[model samples]
Target chain A: MADLPERVEIAEEGPREGFQIEPGPIPTADKVALIDALSATGLRHIQVCSFVNPKLVPGWADAEAVAAGFSPRGGVRYAALWFNENGLKRALAFRDRLSITGSVSLSASDAFSVKNLNRDHAANLDAMRRMTAVHKAAGVPVTRVGVMAAFGCNYQGDILPEQVVRTVADGLAVAQEAGETIADVSLADTMGWATPTRIERGVGAVRERWPHLRIGLHLHDTRGLAVANAHAGLRLGVDRFDSTVGGLGGCPFAGQKGAAGNICTEELVLLCEEMGVRTGVDLDALIEVGRMAERIVGHALPSELLRAGSLDAFRRKQAA
Target chain B: MADLPERVEIAEEGPREGFQIEPGPIPTADKVALIDALSATGLRHIQVCSFVNPKLVPGWADAEAVAAGFSPRGGVRYAALWFNENGLKRALAFRDRLSITGSVSLSASDAFSVKNLNRDHAANLDAMRRMTAVHKAAGVPVTRVGVMAAFGCNYQGDILPEQVVRTVADGLAVAQEAGETIADVSLADTMGWATPTRIERGVGAVRERWPHLRIGLHLHDTRGLAVANAHAGLRLGVDRFDSTVGGLGGCPFAGQKGAAGNICTEELVLLCEEMGVRTGVDLDALIEVGRMAERIVGHALPSELLRAGSLDAFRRKQAA
Candidate 1:
């Protein structure tokens, strides 16, 4: 195997992406406690919540309350996801305390784009430009655009590499037109269709085209290839990844009835640590947080690491 | 990333390795039917059964019956596991019909060897030498010695690469003393403690010391790194792997009930195929066989592909 990177960044989005999908609302206090527990686990960045329509995703209705209830740690950076003008307005309310993250989603499947965002590529691009302007005015140094369905899609199967490249390029152009820098480009495998080959080729294409942009992967473990694809991205020198505690949060649009969720944070950390790639997160603590997440969500989780204790822990027990 | 091998050889050991640990006996006819189903799925090699004490592993009491009942396909090879004199005696009864495999266990933790095999290193080495002589006398072209617990053991925490190298060397010496050739040396991660770095380094060390011997991996998905470890092995150009259909079976010694089974055959195939490494097994047929195995086992299996369906199938549905 090739030499792995010295360290990789794991951006936890469980509170936002994970909680937003549940049909039942999670109490703001519980969300704060979960985020606080995750913060102590050595995660550097946490996407705290999403500023969105309460009517559409009532689960995230307590986003402002969650932000207000949570305690911010010294070293950790808290982020929030916002999609449009209204979401940005909500995000701006807590801009003093939160590092804002706005996504300009380019849905390869027009049907998904219309259903999820009620907008097509051109409309979303225009919204992205306006969002970039708002962030620029707010002096937010980095603007992140999530390329939703960057891989394949439920409605539109087999999203070509060119489509991703074009979407990313267009997204960047809009950001640049608004005189804002594209700080992070996240290739969101919204339906968990990001295969290793697809990941490697997509990352390679994006890297070749825009070498300076920080690339991140928002992968779903619906097909159980999330870690494998992450490794593929790591092979291509992509370091940042978005994962959720306990593999929480499913894409309602992914069409798999909650089986598709962000890759498990602890599992991803385990994979990285096993490969000799550093992921400064404390695995044991992260697993505790995963358990807390399972309890908060009122169901069993899909994290293999959470179920099967870490090898180190097992080894320590055997030694004792 | 390094170039993957043009193709990989998947040796299915579900019948022997997967069924042996089950408490209830799988009917001989069902075993034969499963093998027959696997045979038609384009799997080139299948480890049909083990010739061991039925009292110890009643699951395999029908080994002979399973072998006799199943119809072997034209392009497939059948193999069986043999431990000592008794197993060899049983295996030799059908020597013309099956390729025989034995294990030279190196339990980093001595307690595991005692619990699983009822022998220490020196005693197993003596048995290995005797087994090699028997195979040599029978003119078996290849003698395979699986290095059990080559990765780590439940009793013994971590097995170092040096220990694995030493075990392989000692096993080779025994085969050489018997005037026999060791055709294959498999590093068996019985407890699924193997990580990617360990796999690459271990495989690399084995390749460096004995370049001629074919190296294979017998990995378990206990810790969910089996596929990742397989990818790591692939990056080092190791092409042969042992997998079980529907991810059935578990190591009684693995201490996790049924969580640590041989890497799922369809999952492994999917990983390889997605990485552009060829596996001759027919995936759809294997998935159907996986469903059959699940039904025969009277429970839901852990195979992700079987649950999520294949990308091609999903794409076809979407296109339709």
Candidate 2:
């Protein structure tokens, strides 16, 4: 096997993308401790909180407090997620201390968007453009912009790859006008309905059009194909991924509970390690963090590696 | 899409292969009910019980009584599993009413053989040869003889495909000498460690060497690749399969408790249906049987289709 890269950058999504979709509200201190422990794990980027309204998403009610209290390490780059101008204003409060990123949901099904986000695709794009302009004027960098639901939607059967390419093109045009550096472009399987073929086609289309764009994939394991899809993406030269520790996130609209945890970070790391891809994260330490998260959440987290441990660890136990 | 083939023939393995490795003894009444329900599901071939020693496998202590008391169905061919000359005698008691199938563990792994059946490979083959001689003397036909651990073993990583082919050849020679017809030769992944590529290679090897032999596949879903491997086998022209309802079987020696149920029957049927391969199994009815088995077992079974329902059913709910 070829040697792995020296350092692979993994962006943590547990705080923003993970916690925002969780049903009940988790305490601010507990969330802070979770983030703190995660920060110490050698992760280059950690999306600590989202600036959405507390009334809209009660799970992230402590977003501002959590953002302010985070103890940033020397090498860690903390980031926050924002939706529109108002959320961007809230996110800018921590701009001097941490990086800020913007995101928008681009649903293949208009019904899902109107029902879940209360806005259609065009309206969401318009809001993103205005937010980008405001961030540019304030001299805060819009590090990343993501397009969610690039794969098939729950309400709609198959999402065309062309639609995703067009959406990414439109987002790029908007980012250009705002004079913002488009740090990364991400495609999300928001409903966990993506197959490996669909991921390959969609990511391939984006890579073909935007060769220089740093691509990331956010997937859900609703159909037990998340890891397979992630592997497919990795083969296509897309490295950065968004994973919740212990598979914490779910689509509130889909209504399937415990839909397999976010591809299990330990499992992904193991796969990468076996394939000679450097992740720069310790498997044992990540498993410990998963267990800690399970205790804090008052429920068993859906991570398989925590229970199974690493294969090497298993072999070591047998030898002993 | 091409139309599905008519009259699908499946070999039900709940009684012998399913419960053989179960840690705790399942009640005879429950076992009897499971067989009756399985018979009612239009399965033409059912391996109802095994004639191994009760001391070796206490789970099959009531095998004779259960086999004797089972209500005979006209078209369904009930069979008993026999391991040696002693087991053949026990199987002969039910020979007039049902077909008798004998099995020999032809694994390359001595450790797995000792752990599973308390015999080495050479000893098991010798026992099978002697058993075949007895069946020939009685003018009874041996319905099936299987080569276990054909692809890979949990105890010993990779088993040579040639070893499997040679074992089948030896078993066939013994049956020919005894004047007993070898109705089918099965390749079993008793430890559930075979991948799709391995399935193609192993099954392809068997088919190429013995084109006249009726081939079968017995798979376990220990690593979530059972269905994919089964698909590979189907593509390789091996039709007969051994699947327990709700994938309810595990190897006692494998050391993992409650490994994911056999490649879930409902999931298998759904895949076959979508792929235009005829299994002649009702998806909805199979789900009902799976639920019944789950109830008898006093625990939820590991069938994804039972929880998710059929795709047609889901589409109906969406329309409703």
Candidate 3:
């Protein structure tokens, strides 16, 4: 009980994740509206856009437009995800507008690294080294180490705690060689294969090995256990999480199976607030944004709270 | 860790919950087919149908047809829900095939009792007393006491632990006065207002008061925290749960927001199996049944596992 954190930081990734996955030629103006609305929801960290090749991810082909259009709120850090120098250079164009910290992202499963990144774990470390050097030369701080498929993988089966430890160790070693001071390490359940037990073991291993570094969880609700997994993280004293409003980025609940988006930001905020943990988020306002995201996407996203509403909303009604 | 149950029972309530809520005149054959298919998936307890007034729940108008239609498998207990003596008499007609034990049902929230049950707590207790005597007269055992809105209520706001204990005690008193030996108590998150912390405190308080009685959770995902609340129950070693296949009773994901179904049966199975708790359920078979339910309902249900496939299914694919 004492392990629960006093407050947690929920980083919003709806725009970056949702636009990248939706198979729509969504108007750039709507994308900008989403970012602007999320900004007003008291979310401090919002990933605004993904700077990827337009030819491959046509949904986000107008990443530059979305990057340039939204009104950024003060005290909120707007981020852009880029895989290579090309994307980073494009992001550098908006250096004054975006909070551009670089992350040394690696995959815990060698098979997932080979399948997703087209590189093995060793090769991926080399790539990270090069990317770290690029960020250092460009005066961008690379202070967060991220591990994809940290819980389990589609290509590789169940991931062990020792495997998670070795992956984070590799990322930290890379940072050491690059003279980068890593402030936090984030674990991504890229395949939606995490259970509460796995979260306890995986996060426990990382924390035991690196007690000084802050731990973050990036969970996917591929199998409807994201909320449970988040509760497990909260119980373990993890205070940082990355989520998407309306569970954006995964296949819409009605469209397909097997791919679920990130944990709905409003749901996570509701869970935290109900447990008396300060989330710094107005859950009702966030739920409204979730509804707005659903409207923009032209589908019902996988957020139950967006439909039923926050408990407090009902409480207020009852009080009235 | 020691508190986790080694094995748990997940009772399927899809056909009853889903049909009652779905606007469709879902075919009687489809309801029977769902029940039959779920029996094959190793779920021991299946709520086959609801014997309510046809005008009130037209969806379950053919409860008798479903009750008599499905082939009841050995080792599986088919159950039916009813409210008044008429509904109980309807269920009694199929007593040869259905599990005929009765439950003394009450609501913890006075506001919910008045709004939902159309009676105050004191009045409702009198109604339950009459119902218990009716069950006793019919040679039926009233062994379970169910408290709805046991966690919180939309009309009444938060529910205190002591309130839950009082509600259960009232139900138990009604049963004892009628010579009923209650064996278990179920605390329902009737309005989807329960959190993990509440589950712990509520269930914990009940266990402290009645250590001999088995505790069951009947949770709703109306607010998307059902799985987390279930986990909280598992942590407290509460071994029984009531869930719906494909999240049957709740509103469809894309159709509406707040009125989501029960904690998904497959998701609960996945959680239990992943945590090394025995559920005796074939998860892949259950997922297939969930898909079939979607096909019958002609829409997507709120189960992410129904789409993402189970971890074992992927494991098999990876192995193959």
Best-matching candidate per lDDT: 3
Order of the predicted models by lDDT, top scorer first? 3, 1, 2
Candidate 2 TM-score versus the reference = 0.76
Q: Evaluated with TM-score, which candidate comes out highest?
A: 3
lDDT of each: 0.80, 0.69, 0.90
Sorted by DockQ (best first), the order is: 3, 1, 2
Candidate 2, residues B1-320, lDDT tens digits: the string is: 12223324577776676676666778888788878877777677778888888997788889898888788888889987766677778878887767855543466556567777788877776767766667667666665667777776656656777877777777777676666676778888776656555776777787798778778888776545566566656656667787877777664534555455455666656656644577877777777887787776666555544554554554455567
User: Could you give the DockQ of candidate 3?
Assistant: 0.65
Error of 3 at B202 (Å): 0.4
Residue B70 error, candidate 1, Å: 2.6
In model 3, the runs with Cα more than 4 Å from the true position are: A251-258, B251-258
Clash counts for all predictions: 1, 2, 9
lDDT of 2 at B294: 75
Winner by DockQ between candidate 3 and candidate 1: 3
Docking class for model 2 is incorrect
* DockQ for each numbered candidate: 0.42, 0.16, 0.65
Model 1, span B1-320: residue lDDT tens = 46588899999998888787776778888899999999999899999998888887788888888877788788889998876677877887886677655544455445677777788888777766666766666666446656888887777788888888888888778777766667888998888888877887788888899899889998888766777788878878888999999888775654465465778898888888867788987788998999899888887676766766667767777778
Clashing pairs in 3: A257-B307, A258-B307, A258-B308, A307-B257, A307-B258, A308-B257, A308-B258, B250-B260, B250-B261
Instruction: Give the least accurate 10-residue stretch of model 1 chain A, judged by summed lDDT.
Output: A251-260
Q: In candidate 3, residue B180 scores what lDDT?
A: 87
